[model samples]
Target chain A: MLFSLDPRISRLELPESAPAPPDKAALDQFPTYEVFHQRKENTAYVYVGPVHAPEADVAFLFGKEQFSRRFPCTGMWVVPTEAIRVTEYGDDQQSVYDRLPLLPADVLAATDAAVTEAYDIFHLKKRGKAHTHVGQVQATSPEAALQAAKAAFGDQRPVVNVWVIRSTDLLRSDEADRDMWTTTPDKKYREAIAYKVQDRIDRFKQEG
Target chain B: MYGSASTHDIPTQATTGLENEDPILLAEFEARIARGEKIEPTDWMPQLYRKQLTRMIEQHAHSEIIGSLPEGTWITRAPGFRRKMAQMAKVQDEVGHAQLLYSAAETLGKTREQMLSDLINGKSKYSNVFNYPTPTWADSNVISWLIDAGAIVNQMANAKGSYGPYCRALDRICAEEAFHLKYGHDAVVHMATGTPIQRKMMQEALNRWWPAIMTFFGPSDKMSTHTEILMRWKVKMATNDACRQQFLDMYVPKILEIGLTLPDANLRKNEDGVWEFSEPDWEDFKRVINGDGPCNAERIAVRRAAEENGAWVRRAMQQPKAQYVRPLA
Candidate 1:
């Protein structure tokens, strides 16, 4: 029974073995797709749900297509799985997490303003080391970084938990693409959010 | 799990929990509910709270999914282009409602696929309303007006129900239900003034659905049932009778105003200013939930087909595409 995955269903017990993550052997063979969603305006990007694809471009296209097909969706981001420096359960390799806060010291000398930038989302909230401030300042200067983070985040919503990378590190949509980013209207009648059942109720009642 | 933080916490305590556990913790749990603190997910609760919620949420989810069928039938048959588009949009909203419901059930640790499979396999429960057939477009109006109205009132009561996520979902859902109600009312009004044939269809739809509509509120708050534990756990804010009565009181007059006779000969408004009605065949209610209703087989089959047919889509979404090979290789 669907509901009975109910611990009561009494499954055939298998012998206990050491718990381990799935073999990474299959990882290299699979195409990777990262998911990004836009819940509201000036809201940073969020991980609503995921879908997988092979190449970077294809992954974005698939993620955008599959996840936002149902309702009112504002934006989507799709990145190749490999393009992200994600950590797996059993890897010994240094992850994007391992590289936090340490831009090579001489590299700090290389950039005049990025280091001194007053707490961008990346500097304060460790999670969003990926994207930010829509297309604005890109957290370049300390004041600019703070302003960009503040500007992108309205009402202090943890709506988008992640933001990072030099604006140069990512590929994103431009203003002209806003019309394209809208949920392609397959059929607006199927758009539930657009209809108000109560209004009709009131109108009928008044007419009666 | 122990007691709740409501007046009903003790009363709604489950038989399963009562059968187990230390007497002292059970006592203390009861005491906690008597104080009226909001129950959080991490807080201790009876296994019954989880079970009842799962039952309610899964059944509710199933209802939304199956609820799509009645509207779905009319999506193609709707008389005009506007009605066609409206029904289509309404059916799609039901799908979204199902998503929200399934997610609520998941918070209790269940999965969507598991619930869908159970619904297909005959082990889960959905509302009794969907079991009866929708024989006409007028049935569509009655459903939106009366049927959806029943659901909206019930859902509105849940806005303050105990489970946080489910309650929150109900709040959002109730806000959207206005449009659904309006859609139904619009259909009813149109049918009321429509050709003789249309009026006859609407009246017939009401007659066919009247009893099933009453039963949809579920069994009365009877002895040996578990309303006590439900109320205590805050799983149900209003009693079954309370909800059903709310439906009749609010809708009976509306039904009459539309120039239709309710099939219930015994149904009438008492001088005390309450509508009195004949009791529904509880046996029929039992038979349906036990999987014996009119369309039980068909509903299950349709769900099974969706689960089976959508397999490739689920797989494709979960899997990566084939990797490209070097030309030399």
Candidate 2:
């Protein structure tokens, strides 16, 4: 809900003059604008939260007051929330998104013959971190998607590098193919299994 | 502290059902916690875990918003430009904390609207210290210094909690609150060491707030329970008494160094190294938390009014085509 306080108890009164137009009071509420913050000039803008404002300038000011006042933010961008298009992968839709890496021969043949479109892809790399995307915006892009990606998934956190590629160039492993990447028997190569520094140090102390 | 450290009295019967959960599932959950793994939004958890977390986080969210009211009054009447801007920024931070907390609690299934409605209707409680009046500029400074100090102690412990979202939010909040503590201490120091009139006002404010500040960590551990399970769950990170002691250990010397005296004559550190003081009036603590404090009605009334006044703004922004999706932290 946009508002949590009950509106029924409001004491606002209407005038007794001729009835007003239906949309007369409609302009009071502003559009919900998404805020992105750039922590440093070298970093990309990351999506922070949304602010309601009638115009871009007002939204920038509100964003500063709401999100940037105490935090160290090098820059900020505000765009209306509607400007962005999102494709969400939810729990119930697993069957559609979760496919195995090995596909039918026809599908593989079709993939090789397909034309590619430049697309900006974003990644949520870490938990509790806000840098949403990693790929650079392709110069040949739809006006709306590029702007949305820049505003919504632009550099807001420190990223070492950015890569530009066509949408068709990206390859994703299907959920059914999890074991292909994860079923390695080389447990000793993983840090959690490999690093026993504490154990080693204790053994050394005991030997000494 | 924007969030209350008050312990809700949980009945013994509440844990009876919790004991009957599938043992195998419970063991795995406990093992994850024991290994310091964070429980995420999609994680499997016991019903009691969700219930306790919701209540604690919801109450904390309420505390932040309600906590804004007392010091918010000083934004306009602040003596100078610096104080005015700083006070405004600080109060805004508290409200932002509320927004963050409400969103965190929403991950557990309770909607922000329901939490806020509970707050307005007096079904939920906030920090007891906020229920007292901020009658003077000095009073605001005292709250900033002492109450926020107490919050830092409590919240820092909670930052290490097993809940991923709550811990992440607390990490960010504690960083901001550290700045608030400095801001508060700076303001208090100026008053305490200033002119005679300023000194007196500061002293009186400190005196008035001491009792409430003492109660900020809630009653002593002897009177509270249902905490063993919470501690294991990493929900209640520290006992009310433990937090209070830590606050005293960190702050008492600083308070004295500023030439300010605590109101309680019995307040002192014993040979055992624990800070000792006259037990705060538990009766008053109970009364205040039960919505019978000096400014409870006024605080809620102001909040209600603000909500009413802003209803049009909220109404104007509603879009029929837009769908509400919780933000990923």
Candidate 3:
């Protein structure tokens, strides 16, 4: 049996020796969801990172817990990785919109305002920086979304890349549930500032 | 809090295979890195860079998971409700760090499943200090304060590394680590200054852990083409010796201030401001890292059991159409 100082492990009665388990199947950890968070009210929803989850709801929960548990966050959004259309990365200090291929004349002409859906546009201001929500644009498709984003945000310099995701696909936190973001007063122990060891050390030194 | 400066079992003899890459693309890639631009997932990179980074980040991720085991065991038996809660929070953060790192590695083309498999099968390595048991609350405290202090030294350097995803993950991980370092310091100080028995236990634990902590950064790196290329790419960040020196420089005074003494007698700062200490047993470090450590079997068994037990839930929750895509930073 695997012995441990913690009786909890000893209780498990794990075998001392066992054959290595088989490798997990692909997607065993599930698909990825790109996460974005608002650090405070009236701030852009910036990309934090990605989380692996079974679905959008779980993704949102994981995103919130992973991205905002230690930091203050007022809002969160999680979208499936496959849903976000990404542009080629551009050089730092140069706008990626400059390299965007022109939308075909027929596609541009065929743009019907009534049929267009709302798409969220995100911009990478520089390489190694997180993408931030620039604005929303009405577009017929992901391709057109880039063009629409260009017309709206292309003038912004140092756009290293862009991500276009359908606004409907984003599983956003409900504004009514803002209480979830407020950390409890009892959890101060988890903050670095909560510990005061220097005082104790000083006392020991003084007494010695 | 466990991003080790050293990648255990680095294949120093392997050829870099740079000849196969297109000259123009290689030049551009090198130039981009030289210009201090971060390499994205879609960017063309040398085969060696991809392989080395995948291994390093994956190993760092495994360290976070395995490193938490020893500390997590202490949560149930922590001295008080506050300490227990803090311990629990720290363990949760470590596991969360593993999730973030796994996603970062996944962007390099490896699946999280494969990484976990490698960890259980002993194909990869975590920080070797965790392979030793934390026998007492004081032992666990040593880990919280000193082991984490060592890790912070390593991780702070790696946060400035070139990989976009790994750097991003480290930035977040480092932010959470501030609490861990302070909490650990607080825990150790509480024990060191508390009572006669408390001080003795803290001292004993420090004596037991000092060797493993010395080896935590791994052996001094031999300069070779392999190491040279990684440094130029900003992948290795700092040498193992440099990280160890920095750790000692920053933390040794703090440790001594609280009345705790490291077991090493030769450990001292020279007039040149360099630390000189007894050489850690690299042979023992190698042996333990290769699965002969005191707690290696137990750690792997526990991890493997958790994976097996949770398999059913994962299977149930998994969607047939779920497609994995590289994470966008």
The DockQ scores of all candidates, in the order shown, are 0.08, 0.05, 0.84
Q: What local lDDT score does residue A22 receive in model 1, on the 0 to 100 scale?
A: 28
C-alpha positional error of residue A82 in candidate 3 after TM-score superposition, expressed in Å: 0.2
Best by DockQ: 3
Q: Could you tell me the C-alpha RMSD of candidate 3 in Å?
A: 1.1
Sort every candidate by DockQ, greatest first.
3, 1, 2
For each candidate, give the TM-score of chain B. Answer: 0.87, 0.96, 0.98
lDDT of 1 by residue, B223-289 (tens): 4447656677567788767777787888777766656788988888789866678999988777876
Q: Which candidate number has the best TM-score? A: 3
Position B45, candidate 2: lDDT: 86
Please report, in order, the local distance difference test score of every candidate based on alpha carbons: 0.58, 0.66, 0.90
Model 3 segments more than 4 A misplaced? none
Which of the predicted structures, 1 or 3, would earn the higher TM-score when compared with the native? 3
User: Model 1, range A79-141, lDDT digits (tens) per residue?
Assistant: 443333221111112122332344455654545544542232431121212233334344444
Candidate 2 on A12-64: residue-level lDDT in tens?
32221222122213223345555666655467666566554656667777777
- What lDDT tens digits, residue by residue, belong to model 3 across residues B227-328? 899999999989999999999999999889888888898999999999999999989988888899999999999999899899999988989888878777
**How does residue B201 of candidate 1 score in lDDT?**
82
Best first by lDDT, ranked: 3, 2, 1
Poorest 10 consecutive residues by lDDT, candidate 2 chain B: B320-329
Which is better, 1 or 2, measured by lDDT? 2
